[model samples]
Target chain A: MNLVLLPEQTDSTIWQINDARQVSHLKQHLDVKIGDQIKVGVLNQARYLAEVVEIQSNQMIVTPVEQQAIPNKLPVTLILALPRPKVLRRLIMDSVTLGVEKIVLLHSYRVDKSYWQTPFLEQLDHYIQLGLEQAGDVIAPSILLEKRFKPFVEDRLSVWNHSQTTFVAHPYTTDVMPINFNQQCQLMIGPEGGFIPYEIDLLKENGCHIHHVGNRILRTETAVSNILGRLFCA
Target chain B: MNLVLLPEQTDSTIWQINDARQVSHLKQHLDVKIGDQIKVGVLNQARYLAEVVEIQSNQMIVTPVEQQAIPNKLPVTLILALPRPKVLRRLIMDSVTLGVEKIVLLHSYRVDKSYWQTPFLEQLDHYIQLGLEQAGDVIAPSILLEKRFKPFVEDRLSVWNHSQTTFVAHPYTTDVMPINFNQQCQLMIGPEGGFIPYEIDLLKENGCHIHHVGNRILRTETAVSNILGRLFCA
Candidate 1:
């Protein structure tokens, strides 16, 4: 854990850690002791250099030093066809780590209906926390689920397209990404089997310029992280 | 499987699929029947459009129409700290899928020694085949293992830097990547805990320019794919 996350407090600078995993990381991995300074951040708030004040077997107390804001979230709204449950977990973590501002779980013609019923979907916060802990960011990106492909593309997608250049990952397209793209944009990635020709046409009608990464087909998770890395200034 | 992989056959146009999984994929997923055309490639050789000639419950036979050369591999070598067995498997597949020319797994100070003893290393061909099948390519990237850090950095790393730009991923470094990077280059990614300061110093002293992806700490696999995507023309 790069930054220890703490619950928000009204008027106090002191924070307490009780999560077993975080405590274990602090004690075992970091080997922190009293008076040792470490990075800590409050959920959805600023990060701070916290000095450990008290230590116990189960808990520890730390006071914040000067607070600093987190890194800016990338101005990209990710529209992904819902991947299988196992891949979805990794995709979510990597997307959040890359600072995607918003994520929309989209249903396409190729997406299996049962993939949307995974139990992991109910525990979104748990996966988001894993991403936040890795990125050392406090803010969680907003996630929206769209089960129907046609209506969402015809109606709801315009909200995401407002002032944003939309690009869809398609294999045979001649479109190329311009270097130094800083404007807000929407990137759509299809599922394992890829979007059918009909689905691609619908996305095109909705203003998504299709682009291909390369001849090699990447997994959903790899494609997401790689595309985000390519789009953002690294 | 984007491209079904076939075993090498000498002076023969017919190929037999006996692998149960591949057979099942053909029957169930692709639903191939007699005379159905499918993409196929011999291991480390040319790709072909194969038409099914015979079919059975457990196996199938196909004849190649015409052989075509595979796409060119990316002009890059990847030097990575050996991750744990689980992540290592995915990293190998993803690297090969991204068309890395070479991969060197180096041992850093923080890398757990047991990670090198994984049984997965023995079946490296299986993993490479999966990657080749995914990427629709025949050639597999060469893999090398370096167990000692200091000696390799001082001696062997220079060979990699001879004609190629050498870059090591180091967070907080001011070095920025050049856009439209088409030249050959070597990329080094560290282990989970990252390289210690001494190792970073050794790498820099050996003509490696340190560059960081971002403030977020990416997992070894995610970082590999993301950085490769960012560095290459995807």
Candidate 2:
């Protein structure tokens, strides 16, 4: 029942909270009070505990308690094969919560053409907002769309070639994926059925290390989170 | 497009494909036909390529091609707080695909009481079967339920608590969770909002080490998958 959120702050001294939608949410969903202390942030600014000073029909005012420290981001960039729309939403939210700096949604052979037509791409800002609200962080990760696999691998991937490490998550491989903290990393994960042998070979040929998490295969979203978690720890 | 899945059989002459629902899945969804080669598995035997000989309404019969060796399971046991029904299904299936040998679903303070009544629990066998089918494996992991957290931690946790190493995932913790595995270990993850401070303290007092993945907090299911992926790799 945590109601603290960022991007809700309107201004300093006079915190203009006039969001008719949020007003209803505060009144009905969260039962917020005039004097209740709520956690809030001001887009990339410090998070503060604010005491509600005033409440109007669609606006509210609050005073900040204290400035908070910002947390560092994870030292990895994730390149995932665009999954189904439903799964993509969860992946985007989880990636933000896990503190990834960049996310590249690439087209793969197994990806259905219908996934690209999802409204989620148009509502990318909304997804970012949901992530920021949950993580209590201000910085948003950059999301990139790579439609062609070969060009992305040959052209765009070279920029990240100097990364501390590069990993391709494929289940068919026997080699284990290792997490090394010596440098920044770029992690590539496949779609539902995983990358075909030719795609895998292209990644391998272009300096990406093919790694396996285990014998069993996982879904695209689960594999993304799992790989990030493991890599962060390693 | 790679159909090498049909050339790994060796010993078995007859492939008995039971499970009525799966039979329908093969016929309708996969559009599998007689004379079509598909990947199949024998009970605890090996994954092999099989050519469909008989496609009945309720079952299918196939002949094997060659035998493939079985891979080892991940070296960690996951004790997860049972999440809501929807998340729980994904967690169970993902955990299996990640190669876990055993899983224990424990009740935690953050778990909603209503989640216990989900129809997914009754269809647990089907969920496990889905995992096995995806991974092309024969052996299924054992699933256990602990309705009470305290008693389970007090009575049973000690027996399972080997110096093999135990970890409890928590946020805002000083200790970083280890990724490298030195021996067999047990890892526990909390529910959606995470375990209450009291539950965390109790688990810590009972010989579990409290460690965090990173500063960025992750969802329960994500944390579980990540922890297992990292631990098993080491």
Candidate 3:
């Protein structure tokens, strides 16, 4: 953990950190002691160099200093077809660190029924927190699950107007990946076997541009990072 | 395995498949039968759709057909600090699937000495084959291991002259990533903890341009894929 995140505080003068994992990271990685300044950020708030006031195995108390600068978030939403359980945690963490403003996990025809049953789906907040700590940022991206694909696309997608560019990445398309893309966009990535023909049609009809990265096929995780790299300055 | 790769053949019409993993993937995933056409590629050669002549639990016989198109390789070499053993296989596989022309696994100050001793290094060809199969390509990129960091940076890096952009990804740099980089180049990525000051100086003296992706600190794997995605069309 690069930065320790504290819960919403009632008293701004001092803060108590009770999360065991954060405490351990402070104790083990940072080698904390009284008077040592640790990098810290309040939940959805500014970052600070917090001075350690008290230290223990289970908890830590610190006084936060002046607010420090934080990195900017990418102006995008990742509309991902819910991946398998084995691929969930790391993908979420990577997406969070890459600084997506939001993520919507949607269902598709190629996604197996058993994949939605994984217990890991409930730990989205934890993965977001891990990603935030890794990125040394305080604001967590909102994650929304759209179990029904067609209805969500028809109804909720209108929330993003023409000003926003929505894209669906496909392997069969002759269209090329967008270069040096910096504008607001929503990128939809398919599941393992890929989105069915009908699903691609639905997205295309909804004004989503269909593009392929290159001739070679990349795995879901690799494709996400690669696309994000070009989509923003990441 | 998306495509079946065959060993270099002595006879053009008939070929033997002896690899057990390939056999299992063909039986379970593709479910091949006699007279069935399967996508196949010869090592470092052209791709083709071959007809299955015979099938068995341990072996398969196929007849090669007309050449098919393959994806293009990235116009650069990946000069990476040898990562931990756990990260080596997948990174190599990802690099191959991303279509790099060459890879140089170099040693650096922060790289643990024990990492170089991994037996997994011997299975580089296995990872390359898996990558080629996933991308449906036949050519394998050459991998060179440099145990002496100073000598390699001072002596070998000049193989890429001023005409070819050579970069060092350093987090401390204010320089931004190069965009729409289509020409030949070499990118150097550091180890987990990052390269030391002395090593950075040595690299600077060798004409490596220092640059950073963004503010967020990403894992070595994520950083590599992110950089490649921007460096080329991958």
**Candidate 2 Cα outliers beyond 4 Å, as residue runs:** A1-3, A8-10, A14-36, A54-61, A162-165, B1-12, B16-33, B43-46, B56-59, B162-164
lDDT of 2 at B216: 58
CAPRI category for model 1: medium
What is the Cα-based lDDT of residue B45 in candidate 1?
Answer: 73
Q: What's the i-RMS of each model?
A: 1.6, 2.8, 1.7
Q: Please give me the DockQ of candidate 3 compared with the native complex.
A: 0.66
Q: Rank the candidates by lDDT, best first.
A: 3, 1, 2
Pick the lDDT winner.
3
Residue-level lDDT tens digits of model 1 in A73-160? 8888999999988888888988887788899999888888999899989877767777887888888899999999999988977656
DockQ for the candidate 1 complex? 0.70
Chain B, TM-score, each prediction? 0.95, 0.86, 0.96
Q: State which candidate, 2 or 3, has the greater lDDT.
A: 3
RMSD of 2: 3.9
Clashes of each: 0, 8, 0
Q: After superposition, how far is residue B74 of candidate 3 from its true place, in Å?
A: 0.5
Q: Considering only chain A, what is the TM-score of each predicted structure?
A: 0.94, 0.88, 0.95
Query: A57-96, model 2: which lDDT tens digit per residue?
Result: 8777778876665557777788999988887778888787
